[model samples]
Target: MKTRSCFILMGRAVLALALSFCPLITVQAVAAETASASALENSVVKVFSTLRGPDPYKPWSKAGPQEVTGSGVVIDGHRILTNAHVVGYASQVQIQANGAGDKIPATVLAISRGMDLALLKIDDDSFFDSHKPVPRANVLPDVRDAVLAYGYPTGGTSLSITKGIVSRIEFVRYNYPVSGLRIQIDAAINPGNSGGPVIAGDKMIGLAFAGALNMQNIGYIIPNEEIDLFLRDEASGTPHGKPAMFDTIQTLENPALRTFLKLGKNVEGAVVLAPFSKEADYPLKELDVITHIGDFPIDNQGMVKLNANSRVRFQYRVQQLAKNGLLPLTVVRNGASMKVSLPVSSSHPMLIPSLAGNYPSYFIFGPMVFSRATSEFMNVPNGNPQILYGMAFAGNPLMTRRGDKPDAQREELVVIASPFFPHKLMNGYSTRFFSVLYSVNGVPVRSLAHLVTLLRDQTDDLLTFRFEQRDAEAIVVPRKEMLAATESILTDNGIRSEASPDMLKIWNEKTPAGK
Candidate 1:
């Protein structure tokens, strides 16, 4: 304790000596920083949203209304910019200024769930009269630059400003299947800190969007580059998402890998384990190493130099350099070096897809309820890893077919969304909830719509359902009797809709000649 106190005293003495030598310069710098921070506080806002998130467990209806709070900041063009997650699926949204007593209602003018960005328009333009947009820095800030994170984070009613510095920056994943430039800071970004502004000097550098989970004194911000792209894309009426490559990749840092690829010693870039598309004419394929994105050379770690000290993943350059969804790349294939115009896309089809704040499509039969398998639904077993292991042991498609892309015949895996509804028809049946439907009767279940159609057009005496499991029993139901009792079951269960709108349309579609 004495040693630490002595060090602290020595530091204070050194500071006092420096202050005495240049008191005016020191005071002026401090005053300038303080004024800058104070000006930015007025622009920050508290965002309140009433969101109706999808209920994957009960696909028939949405979950209860949830009131969530986050932060936002006024940007250029009389718009309020915030994180997409802050207001995604929001039914109602309102914003309150730093010390304002009344809330101003706002509507989402544009939103990008992939990039986690949204632009809001307020009903009252007079709100901007008192709150002016803070000047934003055009360029990225350097590491170690002092920053002030302003927001109404949880545990406070008013705006909270936390002092920190730029820790690091990288091109990393934001939401699933989306990647962008993210800046990490040493500030304490709490729950409500999301969508707030991170100020440096006299301008705003980024918005605090997320915090590092399970870590202390670490938070992440969305830099101006991403926000600018979102703003420009939103202006086009139809939002064209940020382009990215979802191809399977791996770093080429191993000596054996280089020797196998016949790569030269000086060669540096990430090697492609598998290309995104399997088409014959696709530009990329297995063993093709990506050497450069546009003109920026990539390192073995799949990183491109952003500046003198900052390096981000080569994929980040795809968003900036891509033209008409074509990203220029330098590739080395079979010891031949050449340039390729890689066709990148903003979306990827997966067997189990992310819900993206949308409700899952569902179709409920006599007793069994089925819905499209989604990433959120699959994660329901997270509370018990043992259940996941059990599913894996039982050959659950949810565990096996994850990360797989859709094919011609099978586009999605349909799962038993919920346990059997209360009905005498469901009596004596074992629980088959969460099982992937393999087939119905004698036909393969291609999708939820297909399953509904098969059930609707059934003529057999018995309806047999097979699941994708090793130890599962075939569930047989009295076909005509089950269909007859569906209405009564719905009444007993109080289920208003027989199926989701899309599935209902397929159910009501005309049957073909031979069934």
Candidate 2:
């Protein structure tokens, strides 16, 4: 009897509470919302940095300093998290919270240029006294969910919140060769918004990193799941990058392809167009059909179910389930089902590698300068499309072989980094500023070190410089005169060292030429 009366009383209370809604209730609700907004705003910060980008055109020095600003947010460790590009090559970095007058000195603790994320450490613990970490959601944000992005964009000094809805979510590429989960939103993400938090209700779904300025209603954020992986990896002394498979793959969408594979109607997945390697022992084989990653069944489109209504590329699971540089996959070879443990890696060498926050390595040989071919080198000519197209017309290796993989014949591509200095040694030589050095004295130039070694121990009467591409002009110079002229070239050009540190070490080594 007492329990029944208690239930009746609770029902009456609920009715009374519903009837009590009035101006007082409205005032309290507004006040609660105001407080919530204040908390999120307090966590947003404006980051200032003075950065110096690499000068590939002049490998001896870096570019001039430039002031840059971006947004960041406070995370679990009381540290400021922002995009790597904002603070890259930064000589000084500071942070100012929303409404705060003074900026606090901060240091970059770690950075992942591939992921475009960076962690900043502030010595002053007082900065966190008023700022609190925004809670992060572990799952991907649902499409069309209302989102609020907080950042300090240009044309404003205060924290700005732009409203939008989640547009799309997918595993996408960030920097070259590095990919992660990215969420697209219709939010007007602008300059200076990078690293700002994208909040869905009370939890943060991601950080703004990119925006399509030419297109409307398009912006992208690095999801919290990727951020969590970066943080965990940073916690370890050595951050083994995200485990991934880089081999070529093809969709199993064509009916003819299915028939060619002799696959049953029940079987579906992606087909391996080609293996990443030629070794007979390589686990993956050309024409192999991958049906599953771990236990998740991959569809004919090379996609897997991420949630009840979400499907993403099967490679997404590799970032999640890869362990100890290995990933498990179910493969059907010659229509026979088998389990395969495939090797995965966070990164691999490229023929022309990115600078990745480091300066370019270079060596000076008399009037000519040589450096490894880099992505930055290619970008320098980007400002002038004529030069790039001309190189393309000439079939320059930097353009023709940019995508080629490093092999036994060549570990690195050494290119002429700069124009020749004014000297008699190159009086008649044609200007081939960016040509790939093929050989010296008919010996194949494998790397910058090999080129330096070949040049250092040269005792020939005449040195012939051959380039990699066909129809390239070759130059012949007097060996002894060029060698003796290098010292004067260094003094005449105001160059402190003839080579970079690594090349200098190689040049100074007394080892025999082949050794």
What is candidate 2's lDDT per residue for 1-515, written digit by digit as tens? 99999999999999888878776789999999899889999999999999989888789778999999999999988788999999999999999988889999999999999999999999988778889998899888899999998899988899989999998889878898888888999998998999999999889999999899699889999999999999999999999878888888999999999999999999999999988876898899999999999999999999999777678899999988888888999999998999999999987788999998999889887788999999999886767889888788888888888888898899989999999888888887787788999999899999999999998888778889999776678989987777678799899878888888999999889743432
Model 2: pairs clashing at backbone N, Cα or C within 3 Å? none
Best candidate, lDDT: 2
* Candidate 2: C-alpha lDDT: 0.90
Give the Å shift of residue 246 in candidate 2.
0.9
Clashes of 1: 0
How many clashing residue pairs, candidate 2?
0
lDDT against the true structure, per candidate, is 0.88, 0.90
What would the per-residue lDDT of candidate 1 be over residues 1-515, giving only the tens digit for each residue?
A: 99999999999999999878797888898999787666678889999999998998888888899999999999879999999999999999999998889888999988888889998999778778878898889999999999989898888899898999999999988887889999999988999999999989778899899998899999999999888888888888888788899788899998998998999997889988989888998899898999988889999998889888999888988888999989898999998899998888888889899987778998877788889999889777867799899999998988888989888678899999998887777777788988999998879888877788788777788889999899788998888777667687788878898788898888878652233
- In TM-score terms, candidate 2 sits at 0.93
